[model samples]
Target: MTDTTHNEYTLTCRFSSFDTTVDVIFNNTVDTINDCQKKNYEGFISKQDYLVPEILQQVFEYYKKSYPDYYQGWSYGNQLTKQQIEENLPTPTNAMNLKKFIEPLSVYIADNKNCEEGTFGIYFDCTWDIKSSLGVVIKKWKVAEVGTGDIAFLF
Candidate 1:
């Protein structure tokens, strides 16, 4: 069941690779979730959901690449380096499923300042442990170079 008050709709969507149907919130300035936009979101989610594996793989890679600098001034100190993370983090022959690290939050369409219309964002809770994510979109995938502790990919 889905309902919308204002431009927000809680949709019962079944995204691929997800074992359970998560209730995702859809919000936008273009069109209401009751229209074709809802279908578009569904399709987008399905198409891009597969990126979870690779995304996870990239997070560790990024952490190992940047290392200590981004993780500086920590209570534990900046002693953690790329080599340290690489040594501990597993690099499986195949991409590992790290979707469980993120919890689907909401979908923002035509509302993102990052891009134009047809652009949307799916925010997640993958906080720095492949954990902090702005959302997964098919657009451009660039992990923060300045170390914002989150990957804000847009599509």
Candidate 2:
């Protein structure tokens, strides 16, 4: 059996006087565990390290509150119409922009991770299709870029 563990964290952020909740998960591989430990990072250093969630929750919260405008823009996700996009000037979620959005925050691991690899973000209540059998409208947001890595399409 492969040794792996799942660590989950819930981050709630307020923007434009609205609150959105994000679910963050870390599915750690053995290599990941070993790497974290070698770096002198605290915590159990397991796939589901307890410390990671605690730290990420606060960090994500700060990230959301600090960049209300960024979150506000994405709250609409892809539902924005061309008129709204042009009129309201909603920010598009992209690699270059995401790097700027998250640059102000201090998440060491995040600095080395990217949406396509390091971290996974799932946004709940992001769409209007509340009755869609898949549960509440599900939307996604990936970190896209970490450190100096190239950015990919946003979630």
Candidate 3:
């Protein structure tokens, strides 16, 4: 029922040695001015790849300090300060490192099955090593949520 422009992004982190990878799927929707109603199956207006590292860092801080259950996946609803947002401004290097810009179409179509929906934060099921799993989530960011896990495994 929200009109907010739909935004979606996936943050994937990988650890080759452990054979583990984690992805954070973020989707946010709110009301918008346009009357043309469109349904957004996912959340987020767009995936901002440059912020991946910092966002993952934020998640790490949350998990460490809060000791979240992470059963169904923890939910975090915090607004980014103007300063914080500015600091996360996307750049060519960050996006390239994440491989988001390299394969835009593939990244956009990947399924969200690994991602668990949270109040505002995106969560993933961690059946493997917790520390290793979290390590993957800490790396990589994309400007949009469109892409697959192929690039993550490359790291």
Candidate-wise lDDT, in order: 0.46, 0.28, 0.30
Point to the candidate with the largest lDDT.
1
Query: Which structure among the candidates has the greatest TM-score?
Result: 1
lDDT of 2 by residue, 30-146 (tens): 333344322322221222233333333433443334345544554555786655543323244332322222211112222124323234322222121122101111112222322
lDDT of 1 by residue, 105-150 (tens): 5544433233343344555554344544434443433222212223
Tens digits of per-residue lDDT for model 3, 12-129: 4442222345343333313231111111112322333334454444434434443334321222353655344323222223322322211111112222333322112223332212
Ranking by TM-score: 1, 3, 2
Once superposed on the true structure, which residue ranges of model 2 sit more than 4 Å away at CA?
A: 1-48, 75-155
Model 2, global lDDT: 0.28
Please give the TM-score that candidate 3 achieves against the real structure. Answer: 0.23
Q: What TM-score does structure 1 among the candidates reach?
A: 0.49
Cα deviation of 6, candidate 3, in Å: 19
Candidate 2 residue pairs in backbone clash: 115-144
Which of candidates 1 and 2 reaches a greater lDDT? 1
